[model samples]
Target chain A: MGTENLVRKLPNDIGGDEAGKIERVEHELLPWEKRCHALADVLDFHKIINTEEKRRGVESLGAEMIGKLSYYERWIVAFANILFQKGILTPGELAVKMSEVEGRFSDVPDTRQS
Target chain B: MSEQHDHDHDHDHDHDHAPITVDEKPGYFDLMETAVRELLIERKLFGADEIRRQIEVLDSRTPALGAKVVARAWTDADFKSRLLENGRTGCEELGITFYDDTQLIVLENTPAVHNLIVCTLCSCYPRPVLGLPPDWYKLKPYRARAVYEPRAVLEEFGTSIPDDVEIRVSDSTAIIRYLVLPMRPVGTEHLNEAQLADLVTRDAMIGVIQVGYDREAA
Candidate 1:
């Protein structure tokens, strides 16, 4: 495996390797995450949270530009959708994102053992 | 971190076919969940369906529909005052319930101090209004840290409470739950009830995000 350009991302407590692992998984699952855009166009979380055309304007940006938002923004967009779609954010909801792979950039392998 | 969990029902912890980028499999929430579930069932503590049934029961309350209540309150000061006094009842009027399992705590968001609510123990929440808890909110760190240092946590979310505004962290334990009733946004006296509801997000109400600021109008 090439070690030159492995962009690492993770929680505060986890180390670089750990963060990198999660980031790799998240990236693999969604290299170009656009559930937020779908939420804006279909589910509509952007307007609900920010209450505006620009702030919640994930629609106009298109998947091309949305693919460019920071990982945090992408997560936030999903977060907004959670608040919108469901009246409350529920436990184990994160699994939904990991599973949703329609038109995604990376294909993360679901290694969750049951 | 090992506990007991017996899963008599069909459980799904299948994250198998992800990608090469996900090298180390940082964490497996299901592993812990299974252990805990097995322990409970083995101990005759609870069946999987009982726990699921409990959530189903809690979700039956009226306050679970939060935004509708907030929108109504934002537009009606009288109702807002009622909400401050009794969040559950106020929610009831708007067809919201705190659910049957948990006691609901309503933390009003004032001008001086913004109230941010998080669950430190488990994912204890005002399910009636808020409905379900977020994935990250159930984690150990978010549960523990958010209460101790609300400001630091908010900073991570890209929100920093001003020095002038005091930050209040409310942690809902097993029985008690809290909700942040956001301060009414300024220059919106003329807006209708529908317009105001558009602005009151669950994030602002929970304090992860703050209301917008308008300097020019000020």
Candidate 2:
């Protein structure tokens, strides 16, 4: 499909397209991936973000992000953007928090116990 | 980090001892996950224990739960009818609780018809029952081709259905999930329910492969 038409259609809406062989590979969920999934459940449970909103949030990340990122990666990114869009959390705050998290984990190896 | 993406069973072991050390820098998305989760926790939306418990709940579920349901359906005529009529309540009878609002639809594969499940839009799997979907299920190729070329896809999985039998592809949506109740394999009449459940595999429940009497042969 042309870029124009691909852009017009939702990135996730790739049904009936000619595709290649199936890669029958399985990956165990990483700790972060599990945390992301848990966050999704918590968000939906507390009414902070519903399931439909999260689906639309991932869809709105555009074709590039959709194609580039893995499944849980897209979800975490979408959660950040959706939280920012809802004014529940700011991008600047997330940036600062991410750096803080990065720094805290950098010096400490056993911080994973937290 | 990219090197860690190899197709292997070793990756599954790392999570238990994958410490967040200075030597091992986390990936961009990995850091984002922790950040988003911590930020939400700080906001008091939910507690860390809740996330832990939720993860525990998710981890507890596996294909064994689905297999038990399938085994019950195979042995009990009334349960099979109930399962076909309403999957959620039928599963609840087996004490398999659904964590999400999505309704489960159990499709029976008969001698005349075979069923295949796919989420063409997204990986809308019956997660509460089957745990999480496999990586390939969420990929572009399987999602794109399964709806139109199901037989070829099944062939790739080494499941060849007869041309005389009909292939029914069920596309899972956000509100609905599908689980295929595969027909019982022959020469297993002597086997009990637990033994029969052992023969039922996850791929069989997903409609990719049929339940074979000889597990090693499959």
**Candidate 1: regions farther than 4 A off:** A1-114, B1-64, B213-218
lDDT string for model 2 (A1-114, tens) is 477876667877889988999999899998778878888988888888888789889999998889888899899999998999999999999999788656644533332322
The residue pairs in collision within model 2 are none
lDDT of 1 by residue, B79-179 (tens): 98888887778877875543344556677777788888875433556765765555556444465567566666787777878889988887665456788
| Residue range with the least summed lDDT across 10 consecutive positions in model 2 chain B | B8-17
Q: lDDT of each prediction vs. the true structure? A: 0.50, 0.85
Highest TM-score among the candidates is held by which one?
Answer: 2
lDDT of 1 by residue, A1-114 (tens): 554433331121211121110010112223222222222222221233332332334333344444465433533444434343545433444344433321132232334344
Q: Who wins the DockQ comparison?
A: 2
The DockQ-derived docking category for candidate 1 is incorrect
